[model samples]
Target chain A: MKTVKVGLGTCGISAGGEKVYKAFQDELKENPNAFVLKETGCIGMCYSEVLIEIKNGSDESVFYSEVTPDRVGEIVEKAILSDDTIEEWLAVKPDNKQNFIDNQTRIVLRNCGIIDPGSIDEYIERGGYEGAKKALTTMTSEDVIDDVIKSGLKGRGGGGFPTGVKWNFTRGAKGDKKYIICNADEGDPGAFMDRSILEGDPNAVLEGMIIAGYAIGSDAAYIYCRAEYPKAIARLRQAIAQAKKKNFLGDNIFGTNFTFNIKIKEGAGALVCGEETALIASIEGKRGMPKFRPPFPAISGLWEKPTNINNVETFANVPWIILNGGDAYAAYGTEDSKGTKVFAMAGKV
Target chain B: MSQQQSDNFKPFNVDLWKYDGQEGALIPLLQSAQDTYGYISEKAIDYISHITGIPAADIYGVVTFYAQFRTKPLGKYVVKVCNGTACHVNGAKPIGDTITDELNIDYDETSDDGKFSLLSVACIGCCSLAPVILINDETYGRLTSPKLRKILRQYKRKVKEEK
Candidate 1:
């Protein structure tokens, strides 16, 4: 039996991904066991949403793009279950369309568009929390920080702050309690990469947070994110619950002395709150306004507790860095910057 | 409490606990309150204040600070135009202007017939589809002048047909 994977991210849903999914569902109900339908997040091709890939349980796969609910029946019958592939509907036809994935190294978005984000098992099968395990079981807090520094990853959030150095500052700060925050509030209108990452791979970000918490000596952390992203928010809530049940999160995680927990604080539609100090205030239940920082979030933040804040893409890169030595990650980018940059690819690109 | 306020306040009573005592809970509470009611009513603010203990004045400051908050009721259909960098580069101002013109109201104002509301939103991250306008959940991107007019007319026609 052939299996079908539909891109159901917000972009996809907005462009009738839900209708296409429903159409497939309606068709599958009548003709069960012919095709296995699964949903994946956007693969960065927002232009061609309502995308679906049909796999014939073998090496062959055809990605049908720009698919509408009206066209679902024909695509399923002709392309998915049958031997002949529909060239017209295929987003990238053999020996025709330029393969967009070519010459692009996708680390942060490795599992994205490739797996069922709703399924944590798929994340694990693709080596999800193994970075947390490696960090917890073998590496010390200092070592983790050192390895991160060696990786040479600057923040992808446009500030370009060196992540390891920031982590080190928080780690060494003179405070009784320190907190780590994943700034998932991709408030900048153009930066959909963070939201896409969260929607596609919540565990990777969660794992990254676990590693950061262990390194920074924080017991608790919160992801300050947009509530507008209901799907991503729902997935994250589920991922957090699953992590605790699987012992990937919670006290003494991975059977180590270190303990950590993460919470999700829904950002209530404020762009200014994307700034670190403002984010802290918003999390503290105040107006999302920027503030002057003599004491940056690193020194004093989140109810006057020392907090380390990193952007979504920054933390999203953590598990990969920890799993594959920092040097391996360092090898990808220039001297000034390191690793992949996941641009949202919006507008007239 | 007024009947309208009480009706809208039901969904948030249980959910507000997750944010209890957290100073930052105010914004999310206000947001939830806004979601419950089409707009943030005076009673809604008081209802939120009663539950979360945040002052109505402070809530008003927060609501006013952010553009997302709507003190007044909205139309049945909300047309959110993207005014982010990419959209700006792609002539979003004219698109926004066209929307305001077509709707026969200014930005953030609903039509006289109460069928459509026009608003400008920050980049919704669909940059690839610049010059995009979201009508409710559906996004119409790469739009042109004629297309925009046609889309507007369709909305009007749909409302008329329903009536």
Candidate 2:
């Protein structure tokens, strides 16, 4: 029962990995009980398109590059069944060399490509909502806020504001009704890190937002996803519905006094809507233009209520910080920039 | 309602056919339409406008904003000279000048004989290989004036031979 994994990340898709995946499907249908075929996300060696990793009983995992539909049969027959590993297609032998994941840490992207995104059980199996459960059962809202402040986890969104500070501001604002927003409107020309996370692991984001709502005392949340990301929006909509059915979202989450609700707001392809102030305006059905910030969103946002806004990547990190403790999560990345940052890695580099 | 009234409106309908609604489609949409229809014309603009419900003026604004969107018919060969920051700094001006001299046409303008069209792009992101030129997406980098001239001559010869 050896596993053969294919990198089906965005870069792989653009490079024609879909055809390769279909070819694998057809080949595996011929021999159903022979081997396990799995799909994973990018390994960051985007220069090598259609990456395939094969693992057998006694042999270490090997990666094959530039794989196409034409080479699918050859790969399954020669690489999977035989002893010889193809030399020409070998991009990097990762047995001892930790080129991709050595310097990098996977907190927000922990479950990406490892589990089926559409399944809540898959997410829970990978330790998804343990943080929310821990918060509801043990810690108070103040304790969660304090831990976040200590972690120094700044927003992965471009502005780089401290996440804890934003939460504190929303907490201090005088309002009975507060709103939490996940700014998934990633409009940076080459940036798809947010989209990938939303598509690959929507639960991580939902869980993070639910925790934020608890910490900030917000009862309502809105995910401002861009209209361009149809796939991401569909996955998120489905994930939200699944979470609600599982008692992870909606009224009395985990049987606690906390009750929160989330909705999706789609932007009409406005580039400036990625900005926090403009995003807030857009979500409120106003023109997607940036307004002067004196009070900021935390004080006066989302229909003039206290609001907390964080990007998809920032929210994804929240659940991890709560579950693993702030110190463990904060130990990685640079001093000011705590935690790993996910880059789209487009252009020549 | 009457036969006389229908006949009177027929001339207006014929006048509308001259205008294609492509002028109302956004830049990307217009580019797609152009790619579909070999070239954008008055007929395309009217067709795009009729389908999209956008004014021809608005579509024209978008088409002019993007460098890739062309209003006129292109030549047999499209030579896109890189005028991006790196190429410009590394003497892309001379290459552009040489292209205009050879083709006897300015940027975005097709040659009189419809043999070639000259265009300049901001950046193809091939900065390491500065002074790059792409002839129909086949990038030729590290180009000097003489090398560019030779490449043009080779293309011209190939075109002539094919003819």
Candidate 3:
């Protein structure tokens, strides 16, 4: 069956995506059975939000641009049902964005625009929890850490620390209680990558956390996401519930003894909380001010336990690395950096 | 996590258990106070302090620290004109000036009726669509003076209809 996915990510919603999605709803009521109406997060095309994609039965999809509520009927009739082309309304094509998409190796964003973020089934079908399964059922904690080290993944949270090395510190720490934190507290002025990842591919991040938990002997994790992103939070809630129900999150995952669970803490309003110490303090329910470091988070973090912190973008790359082997991921980027890094890609670069 | 969670934020005097004794509860409590009463009211601060046990002075200090928290009541509509580099280089000054002149209010002040408040904010992270003005959560991007005026008129018309 053909489906119509609207870009309802924050940028999309800001660009009248809700109105367009509503328009589709009203229009689809007349011919509800004709198509499946779905919502997806931003495809990194903030410039062309309120974007609509129609996947025909032939597996060929067309993307429409600058869609308004008024244009709903025409798009539904011409584009979805009749399979007729609306050239002017169309936002070029995948071919047109080849330079944007093809120029970079997209490990982090591999499933961003393509999957229905609200659907765990879609994410699972797209190889969602395979990494966690691989880690929990097969690889030892040491092996997992070593594989990540070999992958050469660095913290994309602007600190650029080697992720595996950080994990190793926490894993070797003398604490019975350890925590993994997904630092979704992305408070940068113009940076929307974290929001996009959490909005677009939440399960991928969750999978990364599960693997991180397994690698560091952690059974619990916290995702300190921005409260400003209610949509991302809501989607993550749904994704976590789905993940738990599937036995991917709760005790005895994949019928193994390794148990892991994830909790979400909302960053009310603090730019400083992006720092690890501040984030740990905020999770402990205090002012999100940065504290002096020495023991560091890996040694003494959240709840004064051995805690590991990773950025949203950093965690997003873990599943791909584990699934395709560290060497496959190490194949991309320069010697300094091993995987594709995302930027909004403004200016002439 | 729920958008509905924000609805419970009325008057800043709910069960503090939801926020109290929990680590990092102060900032969210303050945020909820501002959300409940528009600006963090003195009484609301006291009530929050009473509930959270963080003390009013410390709460006030916290309220002053972050740019998002406001001490005074804002207008029904807050107009945030972006002044980030992307917006600046894309001719945001004239647009900001237009909003200032049309509303007859400087940045951070509300109009006489309290219908419209003006705020000049840092980049809202939508630099891709530079020269943006966000009225409430709705964003008008790639804006020009003409577009700003028209949207303002629409907002005015909306207020008039409600009145």
Best of the candidates, lDDT: 1
Is 1 or 3 the stronger prediction by DockQ? 1
Q: What is the TM-score of chain B alone in each candidate?
A: 0.84, 0.77, 0.89
Note the DockQ of each predicted structure.
0.52, 0.05, 0.39
Model 3, span A210-246: residue lDDT tens: 9999999999999998776777899899999999999
| Better candidate number, 1 or 2, judged by lDDT | 1
Writing each residue's lDDT as its tens digit, candidate 2 over A195-252 gives 7788778999999999999999998899988755656788889899999999988888
Chain A, candidate 3, TM-score of: 0.96
How well is each residue in A1-349 modelled by candidate 1, as lDDT tens digits? 8889999887787777888999999998998877899999887778887788888877577788899999988887788777878888778868864688665799999999889898899999999899999999999999999999999988888899899999999998889899999998887767788889998889989999999999999999999887667778988998999888998888778888888999888877778888888888888777777789878888888889889999888999999999998999999988778887887666666
lDDT scores in order: 0.84, 0.75, 0.83
Measured with C-alpha atoms, the lDDT of residue A315 in candidate 3 is 93
* Native interface contacts retained, candidate 2: 0.00
- The full ranking of all candidates by DockQ, starting with the best, is 1, 3, 2
The model with the greater lDDT, 2 or 3, is 3
Runs of candidate 1 with Cα error greater than 4 angstroms are A96-98, B1-19, B50-53, B113-115, B144-163
Sorted by lDDT (best first), the order is: 1, 3, 2
